[model samples]
Target chain A: MDNEVLNTEPQPTEEVRVVMPLVDILDGDDGVTIYFEVPGANSKTVDIEVKNRIMTISAASSLRRDGLPVVFKRNFRLSDGADIENITAKTQDGVLTLNIPKSERAKVHKIQVQ
Target chain B: MNMLARIRNAEELLPSTLGGLHELFRSMLDQVTDLGPEWLPEGSAAGRALTVETSEKEVTVKLPLPGCESKNIDVEVIGDQLTIHAARTEVKDENDKRHYIRRERSFMDYQESVLLPVKVRGHEAKASYVDGILTVTLPRENPGSPDSHVVKVD
Candidate 1:
């Protein structure tokens, strides 16, 4: 029995970490809607800026006991034909929402035949 | 003949009380080995309260930052990845004679990182903070596929 048990040694268990992104997007006729899930994050701890057709969002979280340090980061750029001025955003219920209106030229239009 | 006699004698002289003890030991070992880490929550630590999700058309990043000012939070995107970083200091009132039994929330600086699925045009991204959440919108670049061509047959 001892020899048989020794031959059937149990395998070591693996440690797995779950890393989930905090964002969602919905496309619409006029613009696109983007959603982000940020719990305990306030407006003061976040920065939103648009420069040279680039939009940047960054924030630092408050540290707690036995908590890992915050290293959250993300970046994105706009398309050439995108309309940046009509963009709007809001945050509520630990979720961020942004509306990006399409440019006039980018909107689809039907032509009437004479 | 002497070895066979000793083996038979030991078999007949086994302790009767060890049966229950052996069963208990087996149960304990089974319970300990069956315990898994899945019982714990994901990202269940202080100072790290953010989840990021991305798609081909846009990238959304969320952060849970309570008692933080919206004006202090900053969101930026470099290349194809998005970065969210913010900092704030909490000032406790010394006059208040409030006793705390337990505290789990964090009160220090924190930073989080999110990798976008598609390449985003940084110049056109937008962000907003309404209640306590921060949402960022990044428009994807066009694949620039060629227009369909017409064919004529003779």
Candidate 2:
């Protein structure tokens, strides 16, 4: 048997890279909070805007000296009726925190007999 | 002659005593040799960092942001996505006479993103910054179904 022919079996190709953004969400009585791990981002480079009941957050970080590539870009789509009027947010230590307050009508209220 | 040889060969067929003993010994030896301090302790500081929780009704995010100011931070929500961005630029004052042994903290710029569980009405979202921590509140969608019709009794 020819050595080359015997070793000519097909080899599998390497898998493709997939980047997924890291995010965490917390639920509270008043509203929900969201946390994101974004390193090397600043207030000026970040933009958060709400239009027609949709909230979008975008940020870009400066390149490092070593030219390390960014890991992933993530976007979240929330329900339509979410109250964005009273939304609050902050970023520090590479962590992004968001607090979303529930609307008054959404909150459960007890009814009293007249 | 052939029949006798065949019968004798069948009677002598028996299990070998040392079979598989070498492999078992090798495995045990490998395990004993690979034990060390790093291998012994795992997940020692697993839960020391900040924790985040989210649900369908609302999205709540918490982070441990120390030594940061609210003025240096910016929060925005577009569609269902919530973003928080903070930047701190510290310029060393050389004019003032000061003795410094070590300066550890450098200029830091941080940004993060969170995905809402439900569609957040951007107009109704609220945001607040306090101390070093930033919190964003996104309300849940209306519980009542959008597509509802009242039926009249015939």
Candidate 3:
């Protein structure tokens, strides 16, 4: 039973590499926002990367002082309407939010009648 | 036929677009080592997994509550049971009209209770939420007692 409990711990070990962070993707008139749940991550330890319409969020959890570190990773596919060059991201209280703005041509706008 | 040889042969037959043998092995490993629902902590019935650590004088409980603010959380202890309740509210900006492309996060209500493993002074328990993790520390009712007593769970 002791071994069973130890083996079932949620903390990740050194060999754990592939982790899927829970996420939420939201869209608005101007842009989109994505939220990732990484329980122990802070601004200093999280990394965001985007290339060829693929966005990946990678983070390391360091909350347990005496426990092994846990890592989190999640990927997203950007739509053609998204403006990749103007994307912005922020991390607060273990939640990472990404704001991906839509391209000027894709955003809805009214054209005045001539 | 050797199992390794057969696996390699099967890998060659699979499309290269699917990441070939490397992706296949990684997925197999993930399936074999996946921690199912059974791995959830002893006391939680419907919430996420919780971590419990015991020391000489106190027992500490840690739970993840991402995006949950302290204002919406409540912790209570009753007899040998400890319960956590929280309601999460999504924060939105006033300027923008929002639409959801794929929404996985929103308002969520959580309530979970756990039976204490050892005798504890429930009245003296203290809890705090920090960096999205709720930590509860409960002191032993009779520390240094000759035998540890397990409290009955209702």
Which candidate leads in TM-score? 3
Chain A fold similarity by TM-score, each prediction: 0.67, 0.63, 0.75
Q: What is the Å distance of residue B30 in model 1 from its true position?
A: 39
B66 in model 2: Cα distance from truth in Å?
A: 12
| Stretches > 4 Å off in candidate 2 | A1-20, A63-72, A112-114, B1-154
Better of 2 and 3 by DockQ: 3
Tens-place lDDT per residue, model 1, B1-154, is: 1111222233345466765654443322211011112222344442244555556566666665543567777787889877777665432346534222112334447677777766678899998764455678877774332224579897
lDDT of 3 by residue, B1-154 (tens): 2212222344466677765555545332211111212222321221235777777788788887878888889989888788999888765657657744445454489888988777789889989876677889999787756445589999
Tell the DockQ for candidate 3: 0.20
User: Per-candidate RMSD vs. true structure?
Assistant: 27.9, 29.0, 11.6
Q: In model 3, what lDDT does residue A40 have? A: 70
Docking class of 3: incorrect
Between candidates 2 and 3, the one scoring higher on lDDT is: 3
Q: Give one digit per residue, the lDDT tens place, for model 2 in B41-104.
A: 2111111122344564555554434345677777788887777777755422455332222122
List runs of model 1 lying over 4 Å from the truth. A1-114, B1-49, B143-154
lDDT of 1 by residue, A1-114 (tens): 223322222222232222222444444456545554445444555555666554555443432223343422233344433578877776553445556676776555779999
lDDT score for residue A63 of model 1:
27
Which ranges in model 3 have alpha carbons more than 4 Å from their true place?
Answer: A1-14, A63-68, B1-47, B92-96, B144-154
